[model samples]
Target chain A: NAGVTQTPKFRILKIGQSMTLQCAQDMNHNYMYWYRQDPGMGLKLIYYSVGAGITDKGEVPNGYNVSRSTTEDFPLRLELAAPSQTSVYFCASRGTGGADTQYFGPGTRLTVL
Target chain B: DQQVKQNSPSLSVQEGRISILNCDYTNSMFDYFLWYKKYPAEGPTFLISISSIKDKNEDGRFTVFLNKSAKHLSLHIVPSQPGDSAVYFCAGGKDTGRRALTFGSGTRLQVQP
Candidate 1:
């Protein structure tokens, strides 16, 4: 089964443009997270969802929004993209318990100019 | 401030040799630690994990060692192969209700044949 799937492997956005990164998992995991990885920096959490219909802000949630409409899907939306938003975005899912292993999707690389 | 830190930006090792990657955390409440390996253009994959209650965990050629008193953890790979070349990340989670993880800047390991 496709563990975790992300759409649009690559994208380019102009300043002030907006886009959404799509993520879906077939594992029926209850926890999903969006993270952005910048060069020479660690992965920073952007948003997360514990389950469908519940989403929460993460460490670096300033320019992003997220929605979890179904257990399989949690999408991250970038509003008013800036140069600082250019980074690789990853979607991860994990079981409902604490300290469970997280499975990540092939990331989407976004370049904002 | 970054709660987790990986001081080494990169490491080089000869094939069949041992490789050690280090990581440190500033938060004393972290109870769970994990290591992930990533190839270029791919998502980070789970490698191994250690709980605060334990000092070491091993899987095949990979071993994770946690020193809670020092707030440091390390990943060791024995008989390293060229295929082991990848970026390695260390992540830590607190025992609090949320179980959110904080990751360190990854260390790029290059195993040369």
Candidate 2:
């Protein structure tokens, strides 16, 4: 399986601009997550979805939005991107059941100026 | 508060030597713990995980030890090789609910030849 895949390995956006970070998984995972890692810092979850139609906010959900319309896809939207949003974003997924190991994609490196 | 912490920012070990990485957590509700390895410009990959029920889990050259009473966990790599160098992240999560993992700042390991 291709596992999880993300688009635009790198991108730079101007302040106030908006874009979507696309994520998809071939593993048919029931849960998907979005996380951002700053330099010298641990990853903080931005959002997560339990299924296609259910989504929830995470630790750092400000300036971002997400939707899971299918079992294989979860997309993250950054509206009015700010300089603070310049960081590496990772997408991950896990199969049904709690405590399942999450598989992560290669990640998208985003820079907001 | 930082629920999970990997205090050491970096560690180096000689080739074919053992490398030990440590993690401490503050949350007693965290019943599942995981370790992930990441290379530069890549996403973190799942390495190994241990549940509260089991104190240890082994996979090939990697072993994870859990000390639930002390809220501590560790990862041990035997015969560390150059290819084993990467940033290791410790994450903890609850076994129930939609609660996601809280990751610690990664520890960078360099296996020198």
Candidate 3:
């Protein structure tokens, strides 16, 4: 089964342009997150949603925004993209119970020039 | 300051050898810790984990050990194989309200045959 999926696997944006990274999960998980991984760096949390309509910022949320209109989908919007936003974006979801192992998407690679 | 740190940026090991990746956290409130493995062009996936209440946790060929007093944790891979080569990340978070996992710069592990 396709556990988690992301759209626009690769993207190139010019400065001041905008785009959205789409994510969807079929696990019916209640918690989902958006993270960006820079070269040689760990994944930094950008934003997260506990469930539909509930979202919050995390470690690095300056150049991005997120929305969770439904449990299966979360989209990260890059408004006025900058070179600093060029990185790999990942979406993850996990059950609220059990070992809380997060399942991640294939990731979207964005390059802002 | 980086809350989580992995001093070693990369590690190389011979096949069938043991590979140990270290992680240290400065946050005292972290109740749960996890390890994730990532390959190129993909998102990180769950590997193993340990809770503050438990000193060690094991799953098949991987083991996670936690030292609460020192705020240190480690992932040990026994009999490392070429297929296990990848970037390894350690993440932890407190259950203050949400499970916000803070990640460390990953350690790239390469197993040579």
The numbered model that scores best in DockQ is: 2
Clashes of each: 0, 0, 0
- The residue-by-residue lDDT of candidate 3 on A8-112, one tens digit each, is 999999999999899999999989999999998988999999999999999899988999999999999999999999999999998887458889999999999
The digit string of per-residue lDDT tens for model 1 on A83-110 reads 9999999999988666788899999999
Least well predicted 10-residue stretch by lDDT in candidate 1 chain B: B93-102
What is the DockQ for all candidates, taken in turn?
Answer: 0.73, 0.84, 0.70
lDDT of 2 at A52: 89
Q: List the residue pairs that clash in candidate 3.
A: none
Q: What is the lDDT of residue A80 in candidate 3?
A: 100
lDDT of each: 0.92, 0.94, 0.91
**Model 3 spans > 4 angstroms off:** none
Worst 10 residues of 3 chain A by lDDT: A93-102
RMSD of 2: 1.0
lDDT of 2 by residue, A1-113 (tens): 89999999999999999999999999888888999999999999999998889999999999999988899999999999999999999999987776798889999999999
List model 3's recovered fraction of native interface contacts, to 2 decimals.
0.67
Tens digits of per-residue lDDT, candidate 2, B66-101, equal: 998898999999989999999999999776666578
Better of 2 and 3 by DockQ: 2
